[model samples]
Target: MGNGTRLGRVRGLGSAHEGAGEWWKHKVSSGSNLLLTLWLMVSVALLPAYDFATIAGWIAQPLVAVPLILLVLSVTHHFRHGLQVVIEDYQHDESRFVLIVLLEYFTITVRVLAIFSILKIAFTTTGVAA
Candidate 1:
């Protein structure tokens, strides 16, 4: 109702569907990913070897275990957001959209399962030491 022009008034206003909120979430997630990636690199360096037992030993340490678990969770969440954006953009047809949705769900499920498995392995190793 003020004297602002139509385009000027609408310039910064985002979609009604919460696109701005999603963008903010993406920024936060990306920041967390940056930190997590650094921790993951250090974790990999601490491993004695590529063998299962050696890797398990490294992961069982509280210093590595906790951050790796958090990294897994945060990275998966960030990846899901990216995949959703891609799905929204590149998927046009109804059938293709349905396929992309299914693929996204499957990807998320697999990622969560892998994270749980890694946590389980780490904790089991920790328990074995006690």
Candidate 2:
């Protein structure tokens, strides 16, 4: 016997049991993204100047760097999850697998580049030229 209605079974569709987890992850990332984005906007708004030195100095602070990193991670993960859903829904067969793998690689590359940029700025010595 199957877990769905007789009609559903006849139609060959069944519960995947995976959507709940993905939904929760999307909700959590969206919430974090909201808060962190607000923080980023306020922080930037309060800055005395938008010059490279000022921005770099601000990012170098541990307090700033940590949340910035969190924001980067949340945004990237959210992006990947959303795109994966779209690809899975719209694409078919082998192409779906290919698109998903490409999406994963693209998201990973972007996250790595973002985190690396943050770390490079955060750890660099003060008074360095841009």
Candidate 3:
């Protein structure tokens, strides 16, 4: 039952399609994540006490609102990109492709909605409309 080898029958297998751009995007995303994480950690640590009204006021401040919203957006974006890459690498198939695209779009939409919500909160606190 020994046919020596199957190497001679192997054909048409192409190389992977990964590019340098994906790697660069991942690096940039990681860097942004690191910065955002640091900001979040430091902000949480600076709070001596966490009360509902106190926290609301902090979130309303322009200084805190802008960075906090940015951090959330950046982190969400990074997460979506990283997960998409992981899915691309590990999942290979047409159905998976459609699912991955849907997932990415959903995550991005959620990120935008979250940022809008944060902006709404900040604006409301400052007594502004729209």
Candidate 4:
């Protein structure tokens, strides 16, 4: 009501018009994670064996690989969002920025390694060692 808008002086007000998008993203990722987790359990349960050959062959299929990749991405995103809210809520000091940055870097690194491993197994592995 003074020389600036409420957000400029109120601090943390109105969500900076970003809360809805972040909320929706978090919820969507959660839903995807649940569905993919169910798929994983059922798929593995239906397998003939839990051996390396059996699992590798299953992941090599396009249908399986795609969903597995999606699951990885979704889980990574959900983890990031969940941690971000925690950081935002409990951390009020300047360290919050550093923590958030580190969180993002960590999530990215984990996601890349996970996806790469999945792809490698799906494409390069021969299912079982000779």
Candidate 5:
């Protein structure tokens, strides 16, 4: 028989078999977030100036754009995963599914917007106006 108590077996409320994967994902994402945040802070601090032109030129670099995209993606994924855990634990059954769906949509929307902005800046010519 399964390791759970008799009542757990009777109620069929045992493990869903997904928690470990989610936990590991959260850990990895947290680590990435720390590193990326430090990178962003140091990079910005070292910048010659924060004007539109200077910042745009900085983002236009391949190295800067790639890490910025990674930072956006990692942060959003971690956000959604963390919120999903909270919603699953505290939210009522009737509302949990809805909240998770909404969270996913919000995360995706923000991530896409940020990535798109980075890509636009990375690919555009420095001489272009607008």
Candidate 6:
């Protein structure tokens, strides 16, 4: 419950109790990102061609689109968590909060755009046919 024999323990001042959860999340996201990225690479490598329409049509399938979206989510989550750790560890200036805010906003915006593009491709062409 306490860190070492620091006197802050008796005064009820100690760890914030948030690091473990954050660490777990980073690990989970990292694992998912690895698997999803490999899936993406294999899927693309097996494609007949890398042309735009061909790629878009491939993404049009629900099976492909869902995993692609998941990849985006996992990558962005990993990205933000990694950067936030850097900012938290090295950024001691007053602007740290601002940087964190900007990081969150950037991550959210990227996630939204990526998901939108995938969904747009997935829903185009036909409702049931890819």
Relative to the true structure, how large is the alpha-carbon lDDT of every model?
0.73, 0.88, 0.73, 0.86, 0.87, 0.86
Clashing pairs in 5: none
Q: Model 2 lDDT vs. the true structure?
A: 0.88
Predicted model with the maximum lDDT: 2
**lDDT by residue for model 6 (14-129), tens:** 57688899899999999999999999998888898877777888889878999999999999999998999899789776677789999999999999999998898787746433
Lowest lDDT sum, 10 consecutive residues, model 4, at 7-16
Q: Which stretches of candidate 3 lie over 4 Å from their true place?
A: 1-18, 126-130
Q: Residue 120 error for model 1, in Å?
A: 1.7
lDDT tens digits by residue: candidate 2, 21-115:
98999999999999999999999899888888988988988888899999999999999999998997897667887898999999999999999
After TM-score superposition, what is the CA distance of residue 42 in candidate 4 from its true location, in Å? 2.0
Give a tens-digit lDDT track for model 3, residues 28-94: 8788889878987988888766886667677888888888888877777777767777776787766
Candidate 1 local lDDT, 29-111, one digit each (tens): 89989999987887677655778777777777777777877777787777777877887677655655576678778867977
Give the per-residue lDDT digits (tens) of candidate 4, residues 1-130: 3356765556543335677898999999989999999999988888888788878888888788899999999999999989999998999877787999999999999999989988998888665432
Give candidates' CA RMSD values in order: 6.5, 4.5, 7.2, 3.6, 4.0, 4.4
TM-score of 1: 0.73
Cα-based TM-score, every candidate: 0.73, 0.81, 0.74, 0.81, 0.82, 0.82
**Could you tell me which residue pairs clash in candidate 2?**
none
Candidate 5 structure quality by residue, lDDT tens digits, 1-130: 5678978756545777888999999999999999999999999999988889888988888888899999998999899999998997898655887899999999999999999999988788476322
For model 1, the stretches where C-alpha displacement exceeds 4 angstroms are 1-16, 126-130
Question: Residue 63: error of model 2 in Å?
Answer: 0.8
Error of 1 at 32 (Å): 0.8
